[model samples]
Target: MPPPPPTHADPPVLVIRPDSARTLGLAGDLWAFRDLLWSLADRDLRLRYRQTALGVAWVLLQPVLGALIFTFVFGVVAGLPSDGVPYFLFTFASLAGWALFAGILTRASGSLVQNSPLIAKVWFPRAVLPASTLPAALIDFLIALLLLGGMMAWAEVAPGIAILTVPLWVLALAMLALGLGLIGSALMVSYRDVQHILPVGVQLLLYASPVAYSASNVPERFLALYYLNPLAPLLEGLRASLLGTPMPPTNTIVWGATVALGTFVLGAAVFRRLERRFADVI
Candidate 1:
């Protein structure tokens, strides 16, 4: 027995290693874990409907309710113009885009904290948490769009060639929401105040955005600063797409996309940098 013990292999190298240096290759990592992303997203969609009687109908309901209120206030009382489009149709179109962007940002910002347990135990890429909300929000957007189509048909307003730009406009909105969401989610782990403030912040943003009114309402002098709000071009573009109103100038849309991309990049970098601390802090 003693002689057999002496023939053992090299002490099973107990290499004490520090955490492997993880570079946040967001695109590469995200592509690699596409299945995880889909799973998380499906979970979110399911949770969104869990225990709810109306289920996904809530998606169609939200924008419609908001549109009714805004139409009464802005159209009936304030007498805002809808650029020859019916006020109901005009407001509904704008609501579809605004709701999607705002909903994505709101849900995404809270995604990390909401899934704290998963974050603590999982070795998956953290970005997937926030990105998962996008698809659910996009589903809500499409459902709302169906309602918008009904409104359009009722009003007999046919979307022209300008409608082709809707995809580009939606891409810009998604980028903007992702950037804001990433920043919010990162900040939220360390500072819980963000959770309380996000709803109020989004509420204020709704009025500031051209969801109820038109960008044309802004005086020429303020147009420069007005366009600075990324939602400005997106909401306007949506309205134009549905109602054939004037599109945000190409330059403005380009500038908005640039800002959106910049925000997303900055947010991703900050999120990755802060993510190492999340498990400990959250």
Candidate 2:
């Protein structure tokens, strides 16, 4: 047999630059760095449960604890309607949906600051910091959903064919939360003040939302403004699909989705504009 010619490697390419390019190419940037995003997400998920005794159980515990507290406060103490479902299941279902949104927003909002050392030492899409939070939050959400499925079975609630549509609702909520998170992260990089107020704002928004209570509780006069919250229709639709609660009007979901998309564009703009100075300030 004759020996084959040796293969040669291609030369590496390198360059230096002074002024940075300004363009709205975040999607392309994120696509290019998809591996980095998955690595960061996997690292976060590991670190999250590394030393914990309960590990992934904490994901189930948090919403369970919250649901218990809410059931006591709203179901027993304050008297809230659950639309014929047990209060715990009702609140848990609602809370489960909200948790996904809240978790993503919280993580993404702080991603830049949390990864400050990496941002300083390395070069990647700054957008990836916020982008990576989605997968981790999604993992948490899926675990929580398993618990929710059990709760639904306990409550004798059955999800119908409509269950197929749940992802669309979740997508709308994710888009909205991510949009806010990106904007908050950009602002957080410049002004640490956002960190101080972001949790409080999230808490306020949680309570202001229909988590423990029913969306029907909102008066007709304020209904218009309530649906304007973007989360309103998404949460309502989620509850409807999962727990069989009354669905929000189709218009509400459509409007909220449109608003979410617009908000995402605005957030991306703000993120890109402020991204250049991240290493300097962060």
Candidate 3:
């Protein structure tokens, strides 16, 4: 045993340290862990529909059901105007945009807490957990979009040339959701109240925005304050693009873009500030 004492010193250890110079190097860190991001997203996507009978069909079904309800409650009963477009088409178009925001916001907001086991056990960019939620939500949005296409054809309503700008509206909505999600997920680690509060907030927001009606229905006195909501104009813009309604004013578009992007940056900052404590607290 004495003679068997190791002749070589202990093996070298690899030291890991964070870059303090920039704690929130989101872009670089995300790129570095891109594979892990996709892995988490794929796992979620599979688990989401694993036991479901309808599977992805639910994506189409959900919005159809929601559109039907909105069409009935607001269009039929409330007698809300949908500008020149049929109320169902108008509501469906806006729901498409709303679903994108709602899906991403809800999923990403709960991501950190939902993945607490992995988060506690592993060391990776925490942002990836929230970011991973986006892919699955985006896939759902795309699936629902096919249904929208067929509905559009059936209605014989052609989107105008402004339809080319759909991507811009989508981007704005996504940015806003991601920003809000980042903040919500971070807060959720410290306070469970956020999860409870968020759904109520989203419900209130749904009614506040032009989900079942046109922006034109908003009284002129409330126009300025309404557009300040950011979602109002973007959703309106998206609906207009797809249903050939009038586009939101240029000023509102600029304001919404600014708010969306600014919120994203702010959320990233807040997440980074709180990230160091996530494993300890959650």
Q: Per-model C-alpha lDDT, please?
A: 0.85, 0.85, 0.88
Q: Give the clashing residue pairs of candidate 3, or none.
A: none
Give TM per candidate: 0.90, 0.91, 0.92
Choose the strongest candidate by TM-score. Answer: 3
Give lDDT tens digits, candidate 2, residues 36-112.
Answer: 89999999988998999998778778989999999999999999888888888888888888999999899999999
Model 2 score (lDDT): 0.85
Candidate 1 minimal-lDDT segment of 10 residues? 6-15
Comparison by TM-score, 2 against 3, better one: 3
**Residue 235 displacement (Å), model 3:** 0.3
Off by over 4 Å in 3: 1-24
In terms of lDDT, which candidate is stronger, 2 or 3?
Answer: 3
Candidate 2 ranges beyond 4 A from true positions: 1-24
Judged by lDDT against the true structure, how good is candidate 3?
A: 0.88
lDDT of 1: 0.85
